[model samples]
Target chain A: MPKQAPVPDELSKPFWDACNERRLVVQNCTACNRMQYPPEQTCSECGSEHNLEWREVSGRGKVNGYCVMHDSRIRLLQADQPFNIVVIELEEDPAIKFLSHLPGTPVDQVPVGASVLVDFQEVGPGQLIHEWRVVG
Target chain B: MAPTGWFPTTRNRSQEGLGVWEHRGKVAVVGIGNSPTARRWDETADTSVGAWAISAAQKALDEAGISRDEVDGVVTCPQGMGSPWAPNPIPEDFAKAYEPTDNPDDGLTGVSADWIVKNMGLKNVKATYHTPACISPALCAGAQVVGDGEASTVLVIRGTGNFSGRYGQYGAAAGDTASGPGQWTNPWGWQLIPQIAYGFDQYCRKYGSSHDRMAPFVLNQRKNGALFPEGYYYQHRPDDLKISVEEYLSARWICKPMNIYDCDMPIHTAGAFLLTTAERAVNMKQKPVYVLNHVSQRAKVRSSVETLDETEAFTDSIARKVYEGSGLTASELDICNPYDGFTLFTQYFLEGLQWHGVQRGEAHDFYAGDISVKGPHPFSSSGGNNGNGRTRWWNQLDCIQQLRGTAGERQVTLKAETALAGAFTPNMSDWMVYGTSPD
Candidate 1:
């Protein structure tokens, strides 16, 4: 297997910087004013060669959907556990979408379209990254 | 809500096959099939979901027709549960689970193969695509259609490895972020929370409760699911599904109005089906299940999920559309599958059919044994995703088995019947109904 390739260059640099700081950032194109993941160099909404800036979000959102993914590689890479995949419909000027796991909560107990706020979980030194979690 | 007819006999009956058959005017899902359930090691990482799905496509094709090249276009969706929790969330009852060595990919490979066949522009070629978590792969197989974008022949099949505790799932981040799988999954950021719990959290909040209350609902779901071998909670019960407010802190925050139990389970697998237009089916091998009527539509607003104005999250527009298209009322069916992953969904599904004047209340009046192909109405006798099995493993497999009359211990004695199956979600909802025989 090709060594699980690193997050490509076009999508790198900034992504690394945010994770090291425990801040969650999404790349929004100024030209198209659309948010993208996998760090698109070209705007997906409009064919514009736009530059992306790491803008922070309120991290407040609702659970549009969810599931107990009985299988995964990412979490297994860290801990041998079955993590939940929570699909977040963000609440921003133009809401963004995200998928991630929760911290310290039993996802099965959660419901659809629930309100939540952002939180962080430390994984490593300067390696702390933002993870979604249910807020009270 | 009285049944229009106790039983009607369809004039179409073909006795070409060797196996014992029944003709009761109602259409029965006479055929059931699958692709080989791949072990973790049998397939490769690059093995496309289409590859896994096509295996079963061939089997369903063999059942539908002898020619392998008669298929058409393809349609399918990934219907397995959407993981919405921690980096790695195990089955509620992980202690009693078996793990697979490998996992399967998502999408309609089964339908893709059908496209390979149908796009050949074969006459009588048609395609359909469907998936509701466990039965996703199977739905892919059913969507085969040829030229003109519409063929008389269509096939639907889905397969699932079913979650057997073989693998764990994690969503590092569906957002544009710098988080690695590990760093992304860590509870370091809130922006990346899975949306599942948020749905429930929102629901509870709006209802003036906490997400913790959803446990009883799920526990009950597990209780009902115990009857099926393929159920994710085969060994779990309501008592074990406990979660406190503090203990339930998992996701960063996804969606609202629903929660974890409110969501579906993500598993591996495939299923397939061979569908022929009623006209073409009449000329084919044996008496095929006829599509007397169907109504499929998606609510842009998820009328079902609305807080209260609607009787249910599911609305009646589509079910009514089906009734009008089929020129039949809910009083016309002998069986039903309400796309039940949870009771709430099922309740709304029932209401949708009821809007078409289906006396769902009366259907439950008959005894389980009395409610058969020969008796009143049998709803999900092979067990629904919630009743017998779920998407992770047995959703498609069980539906096929029941419709085909191949369900081992839970088989109902019905010669003629019409069955309904559906998949409902916030984004899209699909509803389909087929008659085993046209009386």
Candidate 2:
């Protein structure tokens, strides 16, 4: 329920911006040609501090794994029933370590290798985060 | 905000087997002590969990034939994240913080195994902290302390309430999206546990196992729980330990198969292991217990974290590494206190070592019987996590009493050549196989 952007630092600002714009953006290091999310200034792979830019991915990925959570706060946000969260692998993206919320209609039905795209929800104003739902 | 996935990785397990002890280390465990396990201590009491820990520590020191002042290093595990609904949050023992100050010579701190090495301020005095659902890893920390040599003698402490009650209850709101008493709520990352479970369930399904069959495994675990006096659920031995798609938890199932009993209880008790190296143990006035061996494993891949990796299995996950370190195999073990936070956890090991070639199929008739000294493989004389309390105290105490031959009526006649202990499920367990020669 944070009113202001909880985005604290310069390095992580892009992720928050993408959330506000409803467009999921990732950082791609031009030097190593690698794509990363949770936008780090430096590349974890090859450790190059080279040209990094905000690049928009297809916003689609495969469910590498998924989890069902029953959080007290989650109840306040949505239904008191089971909801799915997942780790997804972006298609043909470099620095491919992608982890985020999987927002399918039902958690039980989230399948491995299930094709998914990012879906955003507004819990608080000026704040929208991406959740994934199964597509094609 | 969900904490960023980046966590400080555990101290490298890769450095093990390559440490100095790989050659010259000759450490033998000398003493161990634990508080009696009980259900629900009144937090509003004069006797605090801190007091319980000190009492156990005193008994451990007494058993080790060492003086508290003689200790030069210490090891401690952080108290469990106590209940959010509890009146007093984080029932910390200022006493634990004070133990180092009280003793002065042997104080230690840091996260898991790293503490022993850093604070005991010795090149060799090893120390570490752990949270492996229960006490087995804490016990393993005690062994690592002795083996790594942060202090000539190391004291390992595990405890929580009676002195502090509210801190010992599990948050009911977890898994349950509702605000009901039976609903699930986790202020902590506990909700992540369900996700982990789902990940594991997916693994099981991929392997063609169904939830109906998994229920029997869980029910068998509940039965084992029926034997313990202090276990969270002491009376009911559910006839079936099965996993279901319907999700039988307070909240939408926190992952399939893992139920309330399958989880370690929020506890108000203390357990400690006081260890002295063989050389120092001899000089001390106390007759010391010996540690035969210790083993540990970190995940090789970003493997499933919520449940046992169905493919690699818990036993194959680290048992052989520990078996080699402890110099034991299924054949040589006399007692086993495998980390049984959940049922199939021990069975996972049972399946891997093929405890008598036990296999993993949908309907493998798996029931744990007391393998006595008189019988083939005398295992978990205290009912593993099931029969014994899941609190880590049993893990250490089981090995201690076995080595000391003080298991009372439950004592096995044959002197145990090896007693294996671990915290193998859902985390990197510090597993060790202890040996005994009652001379």
* Candidate topping lDDT: 2
In CAPRI terms, model 2 is classed as: incorrect
lDDT of 2 at B163: 28
The ten-residue window of minimal lDDT in model 2 chain B covers B180-189
Q: What lDDT does model 2 reach?
A: 0.50
lDDT of 1 by residue, A36-76 (tens): 65355566666566466767767788766554543223332
**For all candidates, what are the clash counts?**
160, 43
Candidate 2 C-alpha lDDT tens digits along A51-118: 88888878787777655554323333234445555556677652253444454356456677878787
Q: What lDDT score is found at residue A28 in candidate 2?
A: 80
Q: For residue B368, give model 1's deviation from the true position in Å.
A: 15
lDDT of 2 by residue, B1-439 (tens): 1111111234323233533224113555666666654454553222444445666667777876766566655556643435332334422443344333222211111122232333233243323344444455554555555556555677776664422333333433323222221111121123445544554565466556544454444443444345444344553322322334344333234344445545554444666777767777777554455666655555432221233343345346565565555555666666666666554345555555455445654223444333543445445555455444446556556666667677654555665656767664534566656666422
